[model samples]
Target: MLIGVPAETMAGETRVAVTPETTKKLMAQGHSVRVQSGAGVAASVTDAAYQAAGADMTDAAGALGCDLVLKVRSPSALELTQMKPGAALVGMLNPFDAEGLQRLASARLTAFALEAAPRTTRAQSMDVLSSQANIAGYKAVIMAADRYQKFFPMLMTAAGTVKAARVVILGVGVAGLQAIATAKRLGAVIEASDVRPSVKEQVESLGAKFIDVPYETAEEKEAAEGVGGYARPMPQSWLDRQKLEVAKRVAQADVVISTALIPGRAAPVLITEEMVASMKPGSVIIDMAAGKGAVNADGSVGGNCPLTEADKTVVKHGVTLVGETNLAALVAADASALYARNVLDFLKLVLPKDAAGIEVPLDDDIVAACLMTQGGEIKKT
Candidate 1:
């Protein structure tokens, strides 16, 4: 089977679908790999590296026509037009987005949305969202640290002793945990909070204090768990309580990294403009959920770290608002490697000769979990 790897076309996306290392593995399994020329360049992977791994380098159109296509994001209409009708596409197609679903269905191709990969044990290896979020979380801390005026760690200098920076992490999931760990590594006084109390242990494992807010009912608890482990919309009462607690913490923290997300829903505004105004001016707030929408007033959309206009640099409250989309792309090389491994592991169950004779068994859990649309019909949720 010839598997295609195309360069990411999504604006600001730097990661590619397949890395040279993963290409080598597929080739060793007797699978042919074709990579679009310069696909791995942003990730610092060279065309020569792909060639060395036994992957044929070609143009985007040519690569899209392979037996199977792996991509970092959904391909554009022009790119999809190049694919053969029966070709298989495996990638994070943003299934929740209506436009994305419509395009894939129109293509009449077998599409697997990695974003919909189930949380079951068998599907763990192919969980692209978790893998990417892990990197994003780690990098978010670094980004916050860079913007922060003071050092994360306390230090004794000739002048005086500086106190350790207070870091607050919201969301406490894969990304939030990683952020906590990274900040702690830098010697910051780390504290974290999440709607789900289950992650308290994970936050404390890295020596960060866990800020837990108990809910009154089972329904509230269930909603906190969120769809596919993402956060769900909270009630006004819950949000009010959360704001009161978070406001105190925000005022104390030198840095705040927010990673809370609710799938198929607008990102909840965990930090309000008034809250941002309450913080000391030099504090940094990194909003990981910025990919969905603005987390604060004057919020810029569509970047890994969206910044307000240069001239309008409202530095009054001394808070730095960071909303970067696609933080994983910042570490493209490592990100691509992890993503490629995820796709390869999943494909092992349903590709090559195995794909040849078997009509996509709709009953298969992996297939059922990720198949968003088939035979021109969108599967009911």
Candidate 2:
């Protein structure tokens, strides 16, 4: 099998799909690896590194034209043009992007969107969402600490004693839980809220207070239980109650990090403009859900906060809002390593080590869920 690693062309995408560590493993599996020159540059893996791992360094065309193409993101239209019709593509392709899937089908590519994989225990090693979100969660806290005017930990100095920063984390998922853990390490007083009630124990275990909004009905409880390890859309009544509870915490918080996102839906507005206004002047907010939230009339999308500007840091109501769309990319080296391993694990299900060609076993739930396009058609859709 010929495996190719192409440089990511998407803006702000710094991670690569394959690292030298993974390349060596692929070579051990009787695969010929071809990596585009500088494909791993952004992730700190040099051409010499790939060569040392027995990978052939090639140009974009040589890499993308291979039998199997590994990518950090979905290819652009121009990139798709460079690929062979029947070549297989693997990436964290957005499965919800109907237009993108249509384009892959049109290109006659055997596309696999890893994000669609199930959240079962067997799929944990290949879970790109969890791996990337873990990095994002850690970075969000570091970013907040850098931008925040006060110290996360209280200090007893010769001049005066400084109070510890109050940190509030919204969405207690992979990202939010990481934020709580990170913030706790920084000695901040942390509080986290999530639609899922099961995460409350996890939050408390991390030394963060769980902001609870009692479920009013059976429907609310079921929705709060969530589906497939992801949060479902809570009823409006619950959201309203949560908003009130969150607003109280937001008013006193020195740092707020929101990681709430329902798959395939606009990120719910957890922090409104009014909430921002009530926050302390020097408070910092890291909106991890940026660029996937509600669209404004001006055609701008926000995160958990409507005031958040994607990829931009701005001050609204004297509070600083940091809306970094790709927080995982900021920590490129580790992010690439984890993502590459995910790609490698996913390949085992399709590309057998003892066999020559790939196999799309639709009977396998993980493979079926990730199969975006196959045989000149969109399979998962």
The candidate that achieves the highest lDDT relative to the unseen native structure: 2
Q: Identify the runs in model 1 with alpha carbons over 4 angstroms from their true place.
A: 225-228, 294-316, 352-359
Task: Spell out the clash pairs found in candidate 1.
Answer: 281-317, 281-318, 303-325, 304-324, 304-325, 305-324, 306-323
Off by over 4 Å in 2: none
- Residue 105's lDDT within candidate 1 is 80
lDDT of 1 by residue, 99-157 (tens): 77887888877788888877777888999989999999999999988999888899999
Pairs with backbone N, CA or C atoms under 3 Å apart (clashes), candidate 2: none
lDDT by residue for model 2 (340-371), tens: 99999999999986887789999999999999
Per-residue lDDT value at 142 in model 1: 93
The C-alpha lDDT values of all candidates are 0.80, 0.95
Candidate 2's displacement at residue 100, Å, is 0.7
